[model samples]
Target: MDRQTLDMEGARRGEISSASLQMGEDTIAVQCIATMSVESMEFSPWETATNKRAQSLYASFFVINLFFGLMALAWGGLFPGNGSSFIALVIGGVLTLLGFVLGIRAAMMARRMKRRQPYYRLVIGASDGRRIPLVDNNRDVLMRIRDVVRHKMDSGDREIRGDFDLDLDLVNLNLPTEAQKAQTLSRGPDIVPKSRQRETEVEAATAETESEVLFDQDAEIIRDAS
Candidate 1:
């Protein structure tokens, strides 16, 4: 929806917290409450149509079993000469009973699962690369989120929380003590340009000396030839 509609709705609800929303003179602004505060969530009816299908399928199970039971009864009546027909009737009755019971249970479970919104639980104790359940009432989850947000704002570190799975490296930074900061500053770079220049000069001098020695040997050969 457009901002004007949002603002009008917010105004009706009286939630405009003195917050100025800048829009053109012709435009309107809408202030909305945090999404979590919305009491009942809205969803498309199409999303729930699948549930109706499951319910219908569950309801049909009984009808199907009843029809099969009637068929078994008819077969037993038609074959007075065969004792096996009577045995088949008993087996069908047993299966029909079992199907009805299981079908009812499945219907109840589906409705229960649908009504209960699936929640992700993070169990801190039994954490095995999946859930890490914080305190029972989602308090731990909120607290962790708050702490993580605070940690990022203070430290300016962009590392993902998952990186610290094996080690609680983020939690240890209680307050980079003054001494620790000083110690970090104390370490200096080893290779100054002056030291590197001196080493290069020494190497050049050694190469020059070798060149002169070779020149002297050449001069001796020339002297003997002459």
Candidate 2:
């Protein structure tokens, strides 16, 4: 049997090598393989579809009711002082109110559907041959994940270990503060040249030495005059 083989003999004799353990450790590194953007429809396909259908029904009902209400009002105006005209006016008013209510309900439902839409998902590839999916509706979370993966890759660590939670609240805490971000941005090269800075320092030192020597000469002249 080959040393690389993890057969029953190796298990029975307890002869597992450190190399195998290292290989297992290597498999646990995390890598970002792919990403997917989850829209509202994709996040809850059935729910979104149902909501859309309901919205359409409600909108149609509103339009129909509005048409009937306008027609009834016109009819009532044409046949003034009749009992049927009074009834038509009342019925039209009720329908118009009902249509308004339905329209409002539909608008509310549409707003909710838009709010529940997911922003994106990350496909994390682990060294252990497992692909884990991390999803969130916040763009900030996606940006943080991208930064983490880029840092890991730049450091030559092709794999990431440990469990990475996809929760937005949890991941959001890891984001850099405004001050930290500002500091990072300020790390760019300054406008002044290094050579100019060195020259200024040298000139200042020479001026200070000359001032000191002049002071000593004045003290000597005072002693001679005394």
Best candidate according to lDDT = 2
**Residue-wise C-alpha lDDT for candidate 2, range 95-129, written one tens digit per residue:** 88988998898787666655533345444454545
**Top-TM-score candidate index:** 2
Report the C-alpha lDDT of model 1 over 1-226, residue by residue, as the tens digit.
Answer: 0011112211111111122111112111112211111122222222244556666676677677767776776777788589788886786787578667757865774655455222222222211232222211223433453354344545554442321111121222223455567877797555569989999999999999999999999999999999
Alpha-carbon local distance difference test for all models: 0.44, 0.55
- Candidate 1 Cα outliers beyond 4 Å, as residue runs: 1-62, 74-85, 115-137, 147-174, 178-226
Alpha-carbon error at 64 in model 1, in Å?
Answer: 2.3
Q: Model 1: which ten-residue window has the lowest total lDDT? A: 8-17
Per-residue lDDT for 10 in model 1? 17
